[model samples]
Target: MVEIISIYNYVMRRILLIQGLIGLSLYDEIGQGYLNEIDLECYITDIIPTLAQVSNHLHPSFERFYVCTVVKKVFFFLDHLHTRRIRIKDIVSSGLLSQLLELRDSAKSRDLVVNETGNWFSMPAVLEVYENYLDLDRDHDGMLSKKELSQYGSGSLSPIFLDRAFEVCRTYNGEMDYKTFLDFYFAMEYRKTLSAMHYIFRILDINQQGYLTAQTLRYFFDGIEEGIKAVKTVK
Candidate 1:
C-alpha cells in the first residue's frame, strides 16, 4: 500500500534523515560547501528531484572527492535501509527522505525495528551480497546460472578454471541460492582465508590434480595477474 504523506512532513523527514541517518550536519563541511550560497534546507530541496531519480544514489561525487565522507555516510544509511527491506523505490517518489521516516514510524508502531516484515534476515552481510547477486542475475529467475556468473570474467579469468570452480560448487549442491552463491563467489573473489581456498585446491586437482599441475597454477595466476594489471591501470 502506498502511503500518501504531506509535503511538509516529507521535507522535515528529509532533514531528519540527513542529520540522523546520513549523519550530515549543516554545521559540517558538506552543509557549508557543495551546497554553496544556499542553506541546508534549500540545498536538500534542490536535490530532492535528483534523489527521487536515483535509487542507488548514495556516495555520489560527480567526480569530486572532497565531500566523500558525506557520500559514505549516505551509503551507510542506504545499507541500513536495505537491511530493513525498505528499498529505495519504496520512498523516492515521496519527494525525499519521508519514506525512510515513514518506515521508521511504522516500526515504532509495531514495536519493531523499522520492519513489520517479521524476523530480520539472519545474515545482513549475505543480504548485501544477495543484492549484488540480484544485480548480476540478469534473467531474474531467482537463480544464477553459469552464463550469469561468467559476467565477472572479462577475458581475464580462465574460462576452463571457472568451469572447474563451478564444478566444485556443484559437487556440494546443484541448486544455486544466495547461500551457495556466496560460497561460490567468495571462493572466487572475496579472497579471505577460509574453506574457499579448499574449493580452489579442489579446482587445482586436475586428473587427481597432478600435484597442483603447471596448467592449473597458471590458470589461477592468470586471474591474479589480470587483477594486478587492472589495479595498476587504475593507479
Candidate 2:
C-alpha cells in the first residue's frame, strides 16, 4: 500500500515550518525577520547542550569552532548576496534550518552524526574541515598560501591553476582565510554541482570577460603539461 501524502498536507507542513522559523527570528533583535551571523551562532550554541546528547565525542573547547563553521556554511549556501544575514523566507525554502534543528535529537550513530549527507551542522564534518585546514596551514598561521594549498588533493594541481585561484578567490596578503578556504574546498569537493561548476568556471574564465577562450585553456594547460614532464623526470 502506498502511503501517499496529499498536497494539502505538504502545504500545511511548509506553513508550519515557516511559522516556527519566524518565531526563531525573534532572536534577530533588530526586528528584521532574518538571522544574522551572531543570531545564528547564539541559536546553535543554545542547542549545543542538547546536541551533545547525540555527539558524545564533541570536546568542550570545540564549541566555538563548531558554531563558527556551521554559521559560515549556512550563509555560504543561503546568504545568496553574501549579506551575512539569511531571511526567514530563504531559510524556510532551503530547509537548512530544519536540518540544523534536527541535531538536537539526531541518532547517535557515528556515520549519521558525522557526515549526515553533507550536513553543515555535523560535528565530525566541521571538525574534519578544520583539521584539514590546520594540516595545510603548516605555519600555524590562520591562513593558507598558494604553496600550502598546492599540497591539496594529490598535490598535482597546476601552477597556472593555482595562479588563477589566487587571482579570483578572496585572499589577504596572498593567503586564503578559513571562510574563503571553505568556498574553495566545496568548489573542489562538489565540482559537479552547478554552484561549484560556476565557481570553477569563473576561475577558468581568466579574463573575467564572462566566457572561456581557447587561449585561456592553453595557458592553464601549459602548467599541467609541465607537471607531467616533471613527474616523468622523477620516475
Best by lDDT: 2
Clashes of 2: 0
Question: Residue 167 deviation, candidate 2, in Å?
Answer: 2.6
User: What is the model-wide C-alpha lDDT for candidate 2?
Assistant: 0.77
lDDT of each: 0.45, 0.77
lDDT of 1 by residue, 88-111 (tens): 332233233443333333334434
lDDT of 2 by residue, 69-172 (tens): 87777776776445668886777678777666555554544446444446566666787888889999999888999999999887889988998899988999
Clash number by candidate, in order: 2, 0
Clash list (residue pairs), candidate 1: 205-209, 206-209
Indicate the worst ten consecutive residues by lDDT in candidate 1: 62-71
Error of 2 at 41 (Å): 3.2
lDDT of 1 at 175: 36
Q: What residue runs in model 2 are displaced by over 4 Å at the alpha carbon?
A: 1-20, 27-39, 53-57, 80-85, 106-118
Candidate RMSDs in order: 18.2, 3.8
Clash list (residue pairs), candidate 2: none
